[model samples]
Target: MKSVHMDVHALLDAGVIERRAAGFILPYDAVHVDFFLKAG
Candidate 1:
């Protein structure tokens, strides 16, 4: 779980996610999300 959190933080650092008051959000659009998923 710590590693997962670290990865999320890394994503935040990379501007791949937006950290909100309550949670985080993947800022990519759905098409990019799909591409990212497949690319990953």
Candidate 2:
């Protein structure tokens, strides 16, 4: 889960994805991530 977060964060830092397009949540000891990308 940590690795996933790191990957997403890297994309955000690199401007590959918008801030609103990436996020994560933990529910019931689980990691949940949701990302939205603009369509061409």
Best by lDDT: 1
TM-score of each: 0.61, 0.46
**Model 2 deviation from native, Cα RMSD in Å:** 11.0
Instruction: Report lDDT (CA) for all predictions.
Output: 0.81, 0.64
lDDT of 2: 0.64
lDDT of 1 by residue, 1-40 (tens): 9999999989889898899888998766752534334553
23, model 2: CA deviation in Å?
5.7
Best by TM-score: 1
Q: Model 2 segments beyond 4 Å from truth?
A: 21-40
Steric clashes per prediction: 0, 0
Number of colliding residue pairs in model 2:
0
How do the residues 1-40 of candidate 2 rate in per-residue lDDT, one tens digit apiece?
A: 9998899888667656555435543223554569899999
